[model samples]
Target: MKLARIYNVQFGKRIVTVKPDWLRVKAPQWERVGNVKEILRDLTLNTVCEEASCPNIGECFKAGTATFLIMGPACTRACPYCDIDFEKKPKALDPTEPARLAEAVRRLKLNHVVITSVNRDDLPDGGASQFIRCVEAVRTISPQTTIEVLIPDLCGHWEALELIVQGQPEVLNHNTETVPRLYRRVRPQGNYERTMELLQRSRQIAPWIYTKSGIMVGLGETNEEVRQVMRDLRAVDCDILTIGQYLQPSQKHLKVDDFITPEQFAAWKAFGEELGFLQVVSSPLTRSSYHAEEVRGLMERYPRQKVIN
Candidate 1:
């Protein structure tokens, strides 16, 4: 794919360069999107698709899929690269959220679902109890639906992580977000070592649950740096990886250091596969939970024995 040269674009009051043609997303069926949104609204649920302003929201919603953002939309940490709102003292957890989320899953008839959350650092267990409740609710309402939880580091609370692992979601994902070198700049509140330890411990706690992590490019990290992150993830036996170009969410957020090419993404995909990642989704528009439903097929191919703890 030929990269479209720099073109001045208007983002609110700021003039930033527009994304290349290869990154452009075709309009989705709004009617389908509306149907999904209606279901979410009826349940009073929030999705990362709308919260984080994901570029692929339309496509995902049109396809009757969404990454459910649980807990609350307000994150405790303010990662500039992210668009999710931050709140020092977010409202208390709603006990009814789990049932409502399950109802949405049953209504959508989802074969697979991704349940993620904001960084509820205020919670002692980093909202692990809520995650467990949500998973149980989904299993009750939609027994056949496979579940994936993209969670936070839980302030390096291994016990909390073990609790989530014991819940036995088909997959557990935590995004590395960027290379270690740029951690302070890109993810000031996140710890590189903590992220790796979390994934490593997830596998240790429950090997049957697939461990997944993601990284975003265009944040001024070198290709070698990205490969290093991949190697680190593999060191923890991460099963799935996602690499995507970082599009600045707003003028106040971090600027895009570079626009990675599709060729480079393809190269990274090849590299990740060579390093033994069971699945690697690499593209300019890829996100952590993008096409998460496909994991059901992966599960069938690489079946795992559920560990009884």
Candidate 2:
């Protein structure tokens, strides 16, 4: 029996219908969304938005924004909710990927950039060095851009985490994805404690860099569970938090527990802010990289004010 059928899922008073017309206008500002696709194809690079079937891809790319996936498209882990290809033996790490990525960023003229990767548990350093190379390449090629990274847990390897932090990205993000109760269902190989530790250690190693994490609601998690996740993030001194509705990529993936209302998303955003997060983007359309420019603006403005005052 499906959970929704068995239980009367109360979505509460804030359910929002998908407004396609509004989405087209309010989406990201990719000047040439179609052109960008061709460039990515030419470089043979992959994007998480495409691979994961993220709902915000159209708006993000149309707005001239993208989250670049480095390492390779094939992942070693078969997380229940992910659509990334899973195979026993993956292709070798592309040595030229960093340079190609740098060129792509240069062409896009992106002010804020995001880089993420599939889980490469097969590698010795868990592909941390590769991530560092990509960060450095982006820095060298796009000096004016602010870079953000959404990294894997690296299976609790602090050495790998250290390498990524040393690269000096403006933001270091690793999604907790879901609450502890739903980990087995949503992210079976992930450890909730380790995920928290990754954020905690990121601050300890790179105190100046902003630490961020995101969670998806509507996976059968209760309101209290969401609150607890926020508290846990605050405990780690995470600077940013993003909450979005969970839409199942395909029928094979985990089912959508429920569709959270827009009002509920607003309530969670308010709750997160009160908990001491510097910035929170919570909505059905919110993704980790959504409104990335706003985050950079807040980070920049706060420091300048502190220095001036």
Candidate 3:
């Protein structure tokens, strides 16, 4: 499917470029890369590494770690900026996905595993059951592994949110993706307030667990708007924040507003730290779950401000 065709474009005299030199990564080499691929394929599992076309897949897979994409390769909402498919009627959830995922984790012997899924709005619980099962399976098979859940807003299902929180994930992340002004065009089915509510509720439900959020630049948002988002995240007691330069997935998706410079990313990092975030990962290739294992450690160094129940 032609999900997007807006990564780059050509002008009369100048060829517009969305990717900068700093965003380029070298080819990954190592035996683990093949091993990781073989396991994922054998089990018929999906990973955001491939689905979202992450630039760091080669590096991450080479290191024997991948962010598993559960539920499906299809999402309920068709966010123009995203690479995932826009399926109004996706296939039913696979009941055995959790077990297969757990087995793969055990086989891969990953110390830190990240589990994320496509939106399942058709389901009453917004696919939280699959998340719970995957978490439990990972705990059972590899008790030592740290499980981080990159979740959605659960389509406003509070009970479903509670279930996932009860699963006791090491890190709970719900990416805001973009600033409030761009929410309608960037994520039409998503609400900025709902995103805030998810992070706030997560912090309240599981004070010990690190709460994280992420955003992408070059979506027609100004620097001040980005700073405002960082402040908003901090207000909810968010511990970790990730900011990356948005590279339009395909030519059909949202057009790149501008290619943000590395210097700008560094400046944002400094500003985010000043806002009280434990760790601010700001770079070109910094996707929501990128280097998640290391980012989660910030919570340990920075204590929570919330009054724990």
Candidate 4:
């Protein structure tokens, strides 16, 4: 299938660049940097930032924060927008992963930690057990630390969802990368309705847990289409929403439709707040976990802030 050309907005005389300022902050204390690397090396674990080429790595690491990717680096699904390598077959699951993740958190002395994994459809439970184990491990090691998970759809496996929810993470997040019409082109194997179902069911399964979803613009989607996605998420009672500009990962991947202007992002943030999302981060460089610490603070003080359908 041929890709659609992005619509360029012709303004009066000035040409607006779609690229936003790259977000970066200084790394945290020198002592903490060595601590983070030591734990990662000890556990033989990988991080999503390095694996996916995330733009927030510099700032996050400087803040002494990191999101660990469990269940190995190879992904079963070949999503076009993602930079992670896709392997037809993957290595065996490491039973030691949970303990090592927990140890890493303890070593870093993180007040909050984010854990996510690649799609492991090859496993019987879709690596849900590994997620639970990691959460438990973190909780056991650092009882005061807040744990957040950015999860997969589990191929519509409720049993698997239950396993992760049962671990009792503070936040549960999943991304709806683009509008429904573009799903087939961008996330071909992912279903829009199923993604909604997963978010909706998460609320039903764990009413107290904060539920969140995210999207990326510049995917050849229209402004009206972005608004529609926000409404769909609100209908499912999604508590938090993140809107960001999509960056092309490689020459083999999709090209940028158009660089979204920063002003446009600010406008969208206002629109989302008006739509009743408790929290909305609409910036050109914002990713799903960009303001994770702030989100955790809001959710803690206003536990009932999240509206459930």
Question: Which 10-residue span in candidate 1 carries the lowest summed lDDT?
Answer: 1-10
Native-to-model Cα distance after best TM-score fit, residue 226 in candidate 1, in Å = 0.4
Over 106-208, each residue of candidate 4 has an lDDT whose tens digit, in order, gives 8777888889999998888888988998999888889999889999889989899988987888899999999999999999989999999999998888888
* lDDT comparing candidate 4 with the true structure: 0.83
By summed lDDT, which 10 consecutive residues of candidate 4 come out lowest?
15-24
Candidate number achieving the greatest lDDT relative to the actual structure? 1
**Alpha-carbon shift of residue 306 in model 4 (angstroms):** 13
Candidate 2 ranges with C-alpha deviation above 4 Å: 1-31, 304-309
Cα lDDT tens digits, model 3, 125-229, are 999999999999999999988889999899888899999998988789999999999999999999999999999998788887788899988888888899999
State TM-scores per candidate: 0.97, 0.89, 0.91, 0.88
lDDT by residue for model 1 over 95-206, one digit each (tens)?
9999999999999999999999999988999999999999999999999999999999999998999899889999999999999999999999999999999999999888
- lDDT score, candidate 1: 0.93
Q: Estimate, for each residue in 258-282, the C-alpha lDDT of model 2 and write its tens digit.
A: 7777778889989998999999999
Clashing pairs in 1: none
lDDT of predicted model 3: 0.86
Candidate closest to the true structure, highest TM-score: 1
